[model samples]
Target: MAHQFSLAYLTVQGCPPPEQIEIAARTGYDFVSLRPIYMGLPGEPNYALAENKELLRQTRKALADTGIKLLDIELARIHDGVDVKKYLPAMEVAAELGGRHVLSSIWTSDRALYTEKFAELCDLAKPLGLTVELEFVPIASVRTLAGALDVLRSVNRENAGLMIDAHHFHRAQDKPEELDAVPRTWFHFVHLCDAPAQIPTDREEMTRILREARLYCGEGGIDIAAIVSRIPAVPFSIELPNLARVKELGYEGHARRCLETAKAYLAAHPRPQAICCA
Candidate 1:
């Protein structure tokens, strides 16, 4: 089967959920990863689909009109003093819109708290038929594959999975071969992008690169094929968020280029049929 592609919210950060769906459809994306659970970043639009019934209605209408699937909702973080239950409304909204996954990350250094909250988040999402996929961000508490694996094993929830972002994998210095040991069942979807080979040491620079300046699939130094080939054949969510490119190409144009490059790269480097070691 051909690898499916998703238009990640970071790719078009300014677009609201409904407009995102329309853009994804126009760009020929099979799916869209939404940001319904707002992060409150500066200048970020508060989609508020969970609170605004009209917004939710419009988002649902966009999906129906364009036939673009809602792949996931993002940034469900397990942080200090966080109430995991607060995410329940977003989970309900995603489920209502036929979304499949909830993208999560650990933002707290407190081990016990993160573990407890992650499990709680998974438990809340279980009934809604959404799998909680944990992404190990370099700037976050769970910054490596091993740390993420430990938490997953400790939580041991059936509805929990792992999300590998190419930028994070490289930034954390994780080897593609290390993916061989991961359970095949934990694989859900992946965040695809590339970046400069010179890994940044400072946290602010790293954060800047992750949120503002990621490269397209084959444009930078990341070994995209090596990392992707080891994971299960899942949808690739294009999370390339280059501010310059967006300014030059516009949202639809940039999204189209991202899809085009990703498709071309995947075609040039086919994945092996059997990824798991068993």
Candidate 2:
């Protein structure tokens, strides 16, 4: 199958649902990634799995109308644990909306518990034909590549895998060799972004890093081209949170620039030649 690319919805947090869909479609993105937390504030009215049936219906209709696939549902925070009951419903929603995977992250102190919870969640997801992707965040318990791999080993399920985010990879200062250590098959999804070397001092600083400082694929100082060349081919998603600036330039203009930057990066370093042919 051809590799698919997506623009994550977190980049356009302030926009309405229809505008988000339109932006992804206009940008030449084949898929759209949704983060449930981005739907609304914690206590405010929002699309929780059980209560948001109409909103979910609208989102599905929006994708159908716009021709942009809902590639995945990102559970940005898993504070209490995996919450199998909550997650199972979300998996149903993902399947109903045509999403192939569910992206999630857990707190650092919860890692041990998550190891067990994740395995149970995987068993629940398998029957539904869904894959659970664990994203390692800089602030999360599974911050480093080593920590992520350990969790994967603990889960030990065929459908459980990692979501490699370039930003987090750099933030965690992951060693190059760690990439080779992971069985390429363990990665189910990848999120792409670039940032400068300066470290953040606070949450606001980190937010700015995500929204303002992120460079387009090849334009940044990060060795993203080299990194992408090493990893196995998967469904890569461009997550330029700073691209919200594109709204001022218009959606098509913003998307064109993102795609052009990505193309330039890929051309500079083609995929690494396989050591052995299949």
Candidate 3:
């Protein structure tokens, strides 16, 4: 079987509602991931939960028109102390919109509390038929692959898994062996983007590079080839943070470049046959 890939549009934070589907379709992406459908703004009133329903409807119609799918939804900003209720509705909407997965982050200052909360969230998500994928961020509570694996183990739910971001893998200084250690069944989603060789000292600066300057798969210094070779089969989502460049080149041009680069990288290092899940 051939590997499946998707393109995430979080690079365009303020992307006009009308253009979202257009961009995804024009880019030849298999699916699009949206953030607002799962996570809401921190400390602000939780109006987005109600406000997002219509947006979800529009997004679904847009996908229908463009022939693209909404693969996943990310709740990236909901901090540790926030109520999980604030995000569950978004998860429901994501399911309603035909998304297969919901992404989240561990944001608590207390590691133990955060772990417990994450496990609880996983339990909550199980009955909804949604997979809770924890994405490890360098500045968040679970800052490394090992940290994510620990949380997943604590959760101990079949629906819980990891969403590996290439930037975080490199930022955490994880080795290829770390990738090899991930259980094939627990690898749920993959985010692809590449950064420069020189690591940044400042967190904000580092985030900017991850969001904006990342090159396509084989165009940069990241060891994506080796990482992809070890993982079980999962949808690879390209999330380059260069919206301005994308706008300049137009969707087709930008997507073709990204896809070609990824194909070249995968060609150079073929993945082993994935272990089938029940």
Candidate 4:
């Protein structure tokens, strides 16, 4: 089967949803994974589709004009004192935009609270036809594949799934083979990117690298194919976020390069084919 690619918001972080959709279409992406729910990060552009009606309308028009689908919208974080219901409007907007998945991550280390909130998030997103994909961030509370698996098991909801990010997976030192234990149904899609093999020891450096310095797929040292092949062949969302490259190449140029390198890498290391038995 041919691979379907999604232009993740972080790949062109400065662009709004409407512009991002246009860029994705122009640069040959099958879909887009957006950030309709603003996270209030400093110096970040707030797409805030749920709050901005005009922006949302323009975003819808862009997708309609380009014939690009919305694969997912991030991020419904499970943090201390987070109101899960507050994500409802964004989830509603995501569904309205034809998004199928809601990317999420846990920030607070409180296991009991996070687990309950995660389940609640799944329940809330269920009626809207969205799956809540839990991504384990190396600098966050649930920092390992095993910890994420534990949460999934505890939550035990059909709509709750895992989102494997190539950068985070490598940073956590997770064996691609460990993915075998995860249920295939739990994988909707994945975040694809690459970074230097030399893992950072400082949390600040790790955060900086994850947010601003990820490399293009083949250009980095990550064994991307190994992790990608282990999971079901779902759409890959290119989430590389390199500030310097963006400054040099501009958003369109950087996005095009991101897709180009990813395609080349996947082409060079194609997924293993299943054997047909006689």
lDDT pick, better of 2 and 3: 3
Report the C-alpha displacement of residue 77, candidate 3, in angstroms: 4.4
lDDT for 206 (candidate 3): 84
* 194-219 per-residue lDDT for model 3 (tens digits): 77867788989887787667787777
Query: Which residue pairs show backbone clashes in model 4?
Result: none
- The C-alpha TM-scores of every prediction are 0.98, 0.85, 0.87, 0.98
Which 10-residue span in candidate 1 carries the lowest summed lDDT?
269-278
Candidate 3 at 50: error in angstroms?
4.8
Q: Which stretches of candidate 2 lie over 4 Å from their true place?
A: 1-3, 37-50, 201-204, 243-247, 250-256, 275-278
Evaluated at residue 200, the lDDT of candidate 3 is: 88
Tens digits of per-residue lDDT, candidate 4, 19-96, equal: 899999989999999998888999988788988999999999999999999999998999999999999999999999
For candidate 4, the per-residue lDDT at 14 reads 74
Clashing pairs in 1: none
Given candidate 1, what's the lDDT at residue 66?
Answer: 95
**Residue runs of model 3 more than 4 Å from their true location after superposition:** 16-18, 37-53, 76-78, 250-256, 273-278
**Candidate 3 vs candidate 4, TM-score winner:** 4
Q: Counting only residues 3 or more apart in sequence or on different chains, how many pairs clash (N, Cα, C under 3 Å) in candidate 2?
A: 1
Tell me the number of clashing residue pairs for each predicted model.
Answer: 0, 1, 0, 0
Put the candidates in TM-score order, highest first.
1, 4, 3, 2
lDDT of 4 at 248: 99
Who is ahead in lDDT, 2 or 4? Answer: 4
Winner of 2 and 3 under TM-score: 3
Query: Residue 20 of model 2: what lDDT?
Result: 65
The alpha-carbon lDDT assigned to residue 225 of candidate 3 equals: 69
